[model samples]
Target chain A: EAGVTQSPTHLIKTRGQQVTLRCSPISGHTSVYWYQQALGLGLQFLLWYDEGEERNRGNFPPRFSGRQFPNYSSELNVNALELEDSALYLCASSIRDRGPEQYFGPGTRLTVT
Target chain B: AQSVTQLDSHVSVSEGTPVLLRCNYSSSYSPSLFWYVQHPNKGLQLLLKYTSAATLVKGINGFEAEFKKSETSFHLTKPSAHMSDAAEYFCVVTGERTGRRALTFGSGTRLQVQP
Candidate 1:
C-alpha cells in the first residue's frame, strides 16, 4: 500500500508567477485536502476535495485554488504567487467523511522569490 | 473562532525519560482533537485523535494524550523518549461546522531527545 505521494518535491518561482503542486493519495482513499505551511504561519487549510467535488476551503485568496481528478489525485494552483506564498504545501487524504484522521504526503516546498 | 495552542515551543528530555507536550483548545462544541508529528522536509503524520469516545487516546509509537474538558487541554505524553521521537509535534482541534470537520492546528512544539 503506497502512502500519499507528491510531485516536484520543490519549486522556485518569482513573484506574480503561477505554480501547480500535485498529490496522489493512498489507493483506497477518496478525500484529498490541501494545506499551506508557510514559515511562521503554521499550517492553514487550503482546500478540501471529495469524490471530485470541491467540498470546503480555508481563508486563502481566490488565486489559491485546487481540484481533484477522477482517480482521487489532486492539484493545487497558486497564481500571482508572492513572497509570502512561499511555504511547504502539504496534501492529505482519507476515507470520505471518516472524521479527522488523514494520511499525509511529503509536501511540495515552494519558494517564491 | 476555534483555535489550538501548544503550551511549549520546545522540550528537551533524555533517553528513557518521560516526555510531555502540552496542548490547549477552545471550541464551542464538544471538540475533536488530534496530535500530529512532522520531521524536517516531511508531511505531518497522525499521532492520535480523540473523537469524544475515550478521553485517553493512544497513538502509534507509544504516544498518548488525554483530553481534559474542564481545563480545555489535550496533552501528549510518552512513558519513555527515544532518539527517533525527536520532531515537531502539533496539537490540533477539529471544528464541527456545517457538517465539515476542519482542523485547526497550533504552532508546533519541537521535541528533542538527548542521548
Candidate 2:
C-alpha cells in the first residue's frame, strides 16, 4: 500500500503571506497529524484531526490551523507567516482506535523569507 | 506537561558493532513511547512502540527498545550497526494524562556508522 503523501514538497513565501500544505493519509487510516520540525528543535505537534473534526492541537498560536476532509486527507494553513515559520512540515496518519504508530510523509519544506 | 529527552545528540560506531541510543521521558502517568527513524529528505518510520504491554519491543531493521519504568527511559538498541542505520532517531512520548495522542518528540540522536 502507498504511504502518506504530501504535496508541493517545497514551499517558498515571504513574511505576512499565507500558506497551505496538504497531506493524504494512507488508505484505511482515519487519523491525521501535523508536525513542524524546525532547525535544532525537534518535531513539534501542530494539529490532530480525526473524522473531519479537530481533536487536539499543540502550543502553537492561532496562526497554525488545519482541517481534515471526509477522505481523511488534511490541510494545514498558516496565516501571516513569519520567517520563523520556515521549517519541515510533516504529516502522519494512523488507524483510529488501533494504536499510536503513525506513518509519516516526506514533508513540505516551508521557507519564509 | 510531558517531555522526551535523547541523551546523546550524536553517536558514532563502526559497522557490526552494537548500538545504543538513550531516551528518557517524563510523564505523570503511563505514556506511550515510540522510536522513529528518519533518513535525509525522508519521512519518519516507526521502529517500535511500547504501550503498557511488553517491556521489550522489537521493530524493523533489527532495532529494539526496552521500556524501563524505573529509569523512566525507553532506550533503542541494536546488536549490529549497519551503514543504513545512519540516520536521525527520535524518541517520542504520547497518550499523556490529558488523553492527547499527539507525540512529543525528543531532540533526536543522529547516528553515524563507519564502514
Candidate 3:
C-alpha cells in the first residue's frame, strides 16, 4: 500500500502571503496530523484531524489551521505568513482505532522571504 | 503532557560496528514510543514502535528498540551499522493523556557512518 503523500515539494512565498499545503493519507487511515519542522525549532505538532473533525491542535497561532476531507486527505493553511513560518511541513496519518503509530510524507518545504 | 529527548545530537560510527541512539520520554500515562529515520531530502520512515505489547520491538532494516518503563527510556539499536544507515533519527511519544494522540518529537539525532 502507498504511504502518505504530499504535494508541492517546495514553495516560496513572501511575508504576509498565504500558503496551503496538501496531504493524502494512506488507504484505510482515518487520522491526519500536521507538523512543522523549522530550523532551530525542531519538530512541533500543528494540528490533528480525525473523521473530518478537528480533534486537537498544538500551541501554534490561529493562523495555522487545517482540515481533513472525507477521503482522509488534509490541507494546512497559513495566513499572514511570517519569516518564522518558513519550514518543512510534514503530514502523517494513522488508523485511529489502532495505536498511535503514524506514517509520514515527504513534506513540503515552504520558504518565506 | 508528553515530551521526548534525544540524548545525542550527532553520533559517528564505523561500518560493521554497533549503533546506539538514546531517547528518553516523559508522559503522564503509559506512552506509545516510536523511532523514525529520515534520509537527506526524504520523508520520515518508521524504524520501530513500542505500543505496550512487547518491551523489545524489532522494526524494519535490522533496527530494534527496547522499552524500559522504569527508566522511561526507549533506545534504538542496530547490531551492525551500514553506510545506508546514515540519517537523522527522531524519537516520538504519545499517550492517552495527550488528547487526540498528538505526537511529541525529539530534537533528533543525526547518524554518520564511516567506511
Per-model TM-score on C-alpha atoms: 0.96, 0.97, 0.98
List, residue by residue over B1-115, the lDDT tens digit for candidate 3.
7789999999999999999999999998888999999998888999898989989999999999999999999999999999999999999998866456888899999999999
Worst 10 residues of 1 chain A by lDDT: A94-103
Kindly provide the TM-score of model 1 when superposed on the true structure, using C-alpha atoms. 0.96
Candidate 2, pairs of clashing residues: none
- Candidate 1's C-alpha runs over 4 A off are none
Instruction: Report per-candidate TM-score of chain A alone.
Output: 0.97, 0.98, 0.98
Per-model CA lDDT versus the true structure = 0.91, 0.93, 0.93
Ignoring the other chain, what TM-score does chain B have in each prediction?
Answer: 0.96, 0.96, 0.97
Best by DockQ: 3
Badly placed stretches (over 4 Å) of model 2 are B96-99
TM-score of chain A of 1: 0.97
lDDT of 2 by residue, A1-113 (tens): 99999998999999999999999999999999999999977799999999999999889999999899999999999999999999999999998788877899999999999
- Model 1 residue B53 CA deviation in Å: 1.4
Q: Report the CA-based lDDT of candidate 1 relative to the real structure.
A: 0.91
